[model samples]
Target chain A: MNEREFLKQYDKTAFDQPIFSVDNVVFTVANGGLEVLLVQRAEHPFKGHWGLPGGFVDLQKDLTLDDTALRKIREKAGVEPDYIEQLETLGSSQRDPRDWSITTVFTALISKQRCVPTDENVSSANWFPVTTLSELQLAFDHLEIIERALKRLKNRATYSLVPCALLGETFTLAELQHVHELILGKKLEAKAFRRRVENSEQFEETGGMTSGRGRPAAYYRLRPGAMGFEFVRSV
Target chain B: MNEREFLKQYDKTAFDQPIFSVDNVVFTVANGGLEVLLVQRAEHPFKGHWGLPGGFVDLQKDLTLDDTALRKIREKAGVEPDYIEQLETLGSSQRDPRDWSITTVFTALISKQRCVPTDENVSSANWFPVTTLSELQLAFDHLEIIERALKRLKNRATYSLVPCALLGETFTLAELQHVHELILGKKLEAKAFRRRVENSEQFEETGGMTSGRGRPAAYYRLRPGAMGFEFVRSV
Candidate 1:
């Protein structure tokens, strides 16, 4: 094309831009503990290493980048984030060794019981306690992802009914405390925590007793319209 | 650079990864209300338009993506995110008209008193009331940026004390509610919200009271050691 035509024919809409990708940190609560789900990679580069289950975006695929990531989770892990949100973007000049890859890290809170190991790209899958994950060699920048995910979850526990996301329909408050303590990495003031949680109006007593033989704790779960963001301005 | 050399010596960081950029949403509580800080772009594409304060990342120039972003916030808008964090990344096939730019959005809450607009690239900087922002025209995906920033801040409100980032070093609980009402888009039930907030121990009730108020609201801010990302867990 001539310079005149080229100057006037710049199609911004059709301009060639770089590609985008997504990664996920899928977490679940199992055996009254907090754990992160990881898979053993079968491909080269980081082959034979365990990592967070995620893959590239098929440029030819027919979906948005965010949707593609969630679909990949379902495609590989057989479990989707019951609740998913974008965490951060990891886009250093050389974050990946292949092509220019821009990754939007998404955090997925899913049910631990429903997960099954079933992906061709993966050798095996399992959940590891957050505290005990250092022993497992992780691929890419996954260790950093776990640390950030844990931080976000821990911060939310004190003020929100966050642990409920990892639980089934019915659970005792004691079970909730166990999850919180694990995430918080310490025991909490039982009476103080109980009073505060019971006062939020975010949870209900469920009017049912615990299943165990010990202290019969009150069963509770999230109340309707209660599982979302609420910005509390500090003065 | 020969094919044999390329095969024999693998450069681990050789792929084309989309560069990550961060757009900051810095808000402050001023003039009896909540307001967002914005900058006028001086460069091409969105030149002279009001946009969220942000810029491209010189990844090698900074250690971490968030660090690069925080630097850009001051460079572009002359402001800092007191409540700085990685909110989300916007990376569609064509979000940027220039190149493949996958931007991670960061929202910082600070007392407006701490910041002032002073940069040549930023033509005019000002805080627009959060309530009336919808009526103004914001460049790029800024409208969407504000929406997401508000949502995340609001979502974290009911459960976290991070919002204290928006307040002055010393202020009353009623002052906090004003910031909340501005962001939440509705007046909150004072009695319940107050009770819930006080229980979190996010703030200390300094022996002070509102000068001109009914029943002298109690003063509070993010509790010193009581606040941290250590407990924040992600998916």
Candidate 2:
């Protein structure tokens, strides 16, 4: 049926009424370490509760999903990002206190030193060590959300030097491995880990900055004169 | 100010709508096969579209988020899931063709072959070879949703032989490998893959049904003796 015929038959009474919204899982790298960005609640439900950065979706907002998440993170925390990814969606009923809402989770990474709690609603926005974030009373089912996001990054790290997004612009392989260990929750054999990373060749020797303290370490950046080392298909 | 005073000041006109709901991402292994179930669309605006099984969240129903997703999948496709997991939410404004919708992507796996398509609306419901699933034109952003689901399954497979849910009460090592290969989307070096599989320690020999063209593949079942895994942490 055409529009006119469809409307004539249409009940125009009621149909599916789902509350759509977005929630963010911003993960940033700073201080030679990996961490996640979290905001302290300022209102009820879980007032004084700690959670990932998120809010209701405003249909009127002129922004894409990714844009909205990044904007909210920056506005709420006063930090800009160098890397961001759409993690997953959370839509369990009772995930919220007052309504049945679905949340889209996104992840963002930036220099840890760059974030400062700027918004009034955020009583606190701090970077918690990735090794320890799992032990807190996470507001909502956010603990699970964080779990999935962390796992994705860990898998990504095996084929790509993604933890670099959680690292300084220039750093050592040892420093990078520390991030893999922390995120994967296991100690990777150093020799094998180094071999896999170097063989991929997504990094170029900067021949610039040296590792801080004691022995000097090689500096590298997004590889030049090299392809992206191919996105490895899952195996 | 308690309920009385708050109610007097509250703008009832600004807030008037029933709550929406979220589904889940479920994964399981049976007969040593890794497959995802889907439903044929029933309503208009992509009516008859092949998609994941889900529906509106009926908050008035005495069900939680988990229950809501379970009901939708079972009702829509007659799938009695052994395991159902919440993968993520897809809340894009344009996701639904006919109405404003916020969908929760839930991934599940069933062990029995009898759970095949039975619903009136579903033209067919069957498991896809996870390796070739990405090539199909899934409705909405479900294509991306499945990708995330498969990624979750692959990572989980390394530590937890969750794929056992796709296999039968007894199965061979080759069946297990096939399931993993299908989900991971690449052929595995049998020797290397077997080493990893045996190392996870979640499988047990059945001393039961074993069959093969050449060598008899050993039958194994879930080490029901093992305890459930804890929530994995994220990025």
Candidate 3:
């Protein structure tokens, strides 16, 4: 038979399918620490437990997996992320209680000031410190998902300007370093960090200054059209 | 209802599901170039067309996505990979003709010497040079998937011992550099490359030497229990 004829006679329901879904681990630097946005599940199969913002893919609405992930982030967290990328895909028969399931995970970075968590389609949405995540009772395998996202974020911060997404529109180098330190959970050598950032040429002086305890620090912002710049060396 | 009771009554078939499958972009350094493994489809819709080795996920036989990918690699390529990692997940309505489909892509690296391609469930299995991938009429968005995997492999080669997987059990530093150059498509500075490799401390002298052109090059192999080592700087 020809290709078209074969497709026409294909039976898609001949085999069992897994539950496919998208989940977003939205992150921000707030309250002197890294925080993740999570929603309290209002439905069964881990009701009332905090989980990453996610749901089943809507075949009619989502044209791609990214659309499903962004839709979940906006609907559950009430915030549009500044930076997002696919972290990893996790699947198994034991992860979810419903059935064999697979979830494409996305890691998103946004400023906490821009997020206004809404209680729509969920019990509540809130930001919790990543350091204390082990103390909370989370839904499904979300704790492991968050930990994986955190590891990726920390690794990227070592050699890329990924943590800058958590800062405001304009900020000093000191502020940028602080955000990186929060994500990495360690302090970087100041001179080496500045050298790496300056060498990347991804940032520019905004001709402004911040009046802090030390000498007024010059403000800077990402160079126009610059995004996801990586350094040749880690700081 | 409680968690167990809720799962018992959950209707898994309520929503239309997408066809889920796993594909492997197996890479090897052979014939002095980077090559990818391709299998000719034996069944319709795109029968007779060359595509990445893949098939629909068998829910009963496969316990995880990685298992599905490995099973496809073994069945179609007839080789076990030395290194494997998830490249990305691609899904859409237009990619598949039968129904909405999603595929998790994996990037695998193995030496050409170890692979013995067999046509068990496929019409034929062979290796094609990556440089000529554009000329071939591939099936089911596989060309794009392969390109994405190639980009990732190239990126990882710059700062990690990733391309070493394409080498045999033991090789010389010169042989390792040749593999990296093939993947990166550029000649690396000898001193810088040696510095990065030595600094990572992932390889150890195998006490063997290759008697080639000028001098006898010492052979080396990965340190015991050493894997996925990343450098702090790009070579």
Question: Top model by lDDT, which number?
Answer: 3
Q: Is candidate 1 or 2 superior in lDDT?
A: 1
Q: What is the TM-score of chain B in candidate 3?
A: 0.94
Candidate 2 on B184-217: residue-level lDDT in tens? 6667678776676576666788887655567666
On a 0 to 100 scale, what is the lDDT of residue B126 in model 3?
84
Q: Which residue runs of candidate 2 sit more than 4 Å off their true CA positions?
A: A1-20, A27-42, A46-51, A62-64, A86-88, A91-95, A116-160, A172-197, A211-217, A224-235, B1-38, B99-101, B116-160, B177-199, B210-218, B225-235
Q: lDDT score, residue B113, model 3?
A: 91
- Estimate the lDDT of model 2: 0.64
Tell me candidate 1's TM-score on chain B. 0.80
The sequence of per-residue lDDT tens digits that candidate 3 reaches over residues A109-218 is 99888776665553488889998999999999999999999999988988788789999889899999999888777888899888888999999999999876879989
Model 3 score (lDDT): 0.88
Where does candidate 3 clash, by residue pair? none
Candidates' RMSD to native: 7.6, 6.2, 2.3
For residues A1-235, write the lDDT of model 2, one tens digit per residue: 6544554575422654444555677776665456777778765556666887876655455234665676677766776676777776655456765455566777766656556677665557777776687677778888888878878877776666566666666667777778777666777888887677677767777887574678877876766544224334210
Provide per-model DockQ scores: 0.17, 0.22, 0.72
Model 1 residue B19 lDDT? 38
Residues B88-184, candidate 1: write the lDDT tens digits: 7776556656444467788888777777667775557767888787887777788888988888888766556667677778777777777767666
**RMSD to the native, candidate 2?**
6.2
Candidate 1 lDDT, A82-136, residue by residue in tens = 6777777776545555433456777777767667656654347767888788898
Model 3 lDDT per residue over B1-70, tens place: 8888888889988878888888899999999999999988888878878999888777898899888898
DockQ of candidate 1? 0.17
